[model samples]
Target: QLIVVFVSILIAFVAYTSQIFVLWNSLGGAVAHTFFVLAPFNVFIIFIYINYALTCTTDPGTVPPNWMPDQNTHFEVKRSTHTARFCKTCNNFKPPRAHHCSTCNRCVLKMDHHCPWINSCVGFENYGHFLRFLVYVEIGSIYLFALLSNRLAQIVEELHTSQIRPSATEATFLSINMIMAALVIICVGILGGYHVYCVTTNTTTIEGWEKGKTLTMKRMGKIQNVKYPYDYGVMNNLRSVLGPQPLFWLWPRTMSGTGLYFPIN
Candidate 1:
């Protein structure tokens, strides 16, 4: 909790403070740079909160107590899929697409992966929030990286030419900002790409490894002709996570779906 809170505040502080340098030196000394910088920066922060709140509060959905398997479902699922669906830990029948997260100590319906960053399990109910968070975070990192690099370059040029000797504090601060941005880009960028691949293929982190195959072996598209069933289509798959409301895809809202039940195909 402390770490999460600290990081959030640090992000906001770094952004606003850095913008001070650019705006202070601009012609007429107006706040244009600061305002422009904060526009996307603030939007990104809003998404961060939205994802964090939803992921933290929403129940990932659990198997009902004393649930019974339908006779038809029993026969249709085949012995292999049906046999492994029971959770010995919970002593309950697991739903299709559900997996037991040892960290959570229970079966999470349509379980993705446990994300410690949000201090929550990113399962059925909160997968959309998690995914959206990744997207916005990656965007924010790249955006900041671009903005800060320009500032850093100017400082570097000044130092190289011996035009002005920068103070230790100013030098350290600028370098740290650029370094942090770079790390965010590399770390969050790769993570965001993986989630994007997951969305396109309808595979989660855990699901990709189970059933004896990693998703890297397969490609997702119209003509793949593979065993990935959850992918309805690109747009429909996106809507499944982002909700059906076109205008609200970027807004803060819970996604549509009963986490307890999902269509496999």
Candidate 2:
């Protein structure tokens, strides 16, 4: 409890007092740059919270349609016979895309890997947060790139004959920022690409790769019950990402023999 409170307070402080905000204020009222840096990050963090609290499935009660059986019976575990290793911390069967962090000793649903930076589990519930975070990260990188590029141009213009001498603080800050920018690019780029690929194929990372063979989704005109085609056309794709209110349980319903029944309210 103490640790949790301390960490939460720390995050609150950083989010409110970070250098990014300082830079935003110092950038001569460049609203575009400020938004470019903050919007994506803000959305991402918000999404994470949503996922963690609302949508991430810690229990494995139902097998989603994406789970496939393999030809090799030896390797293929029957769903009826299968039981996930119970996680004491989570107190539930870790669902697909779920992983238990050694450090936390808890199973996270739709696990993306433990992120120390966020000091939280990245799972299905919080997947939205992760994506939003990535979007922000990408935006932040672009902002930095633009800011640096403009500054570099000015320095070149002024120092045609000599190298610019940076103060110790400036040098350290620049180095750290550059490294952070590179890391963000790589991390966000890979995660975004993976998510995109999964969305197009109508699968999650755990369901797609863990089922022994990759499942290819037919380009169905609409996403499940969504009215529009699942193609990357702006209307269709954006809605899918920033989609309709997700099912309360994060899974959609299907018309059954009797009628439509929604497991989650």
In each prediction, how many residue pairs overlap at the backbone (N, C-alpha, C within less than 3 A)? Answer: 0, 11
Give the poorly placed runs of model 2, Cα more than 4 Å off. 1-121, 161-166, 211-241, 245-265
RMSD in Å for candidate 2, one decimal? 10.5
Per-residue lDDT tens digits for candidate 2, residues 1-265, read 4554563454344344434433444444567876766665555445434443332332212223233323332222235567444445655544434556776666544455555555565544445444554555465565554554454465566567676554555445555555655666687788777876655543445555543231222244322332221235434443444455444222322212211111110
Model 1 weakest lDDT span, ten residues long: 214-223
Estimate every model's Cα lDDT from 0 to 1: 0.70, 0.46
TM-score of each: 0.82, 0.49
Write candidate 1's Cα lDDT for 167-186 as tens digits: 66656766777788788889
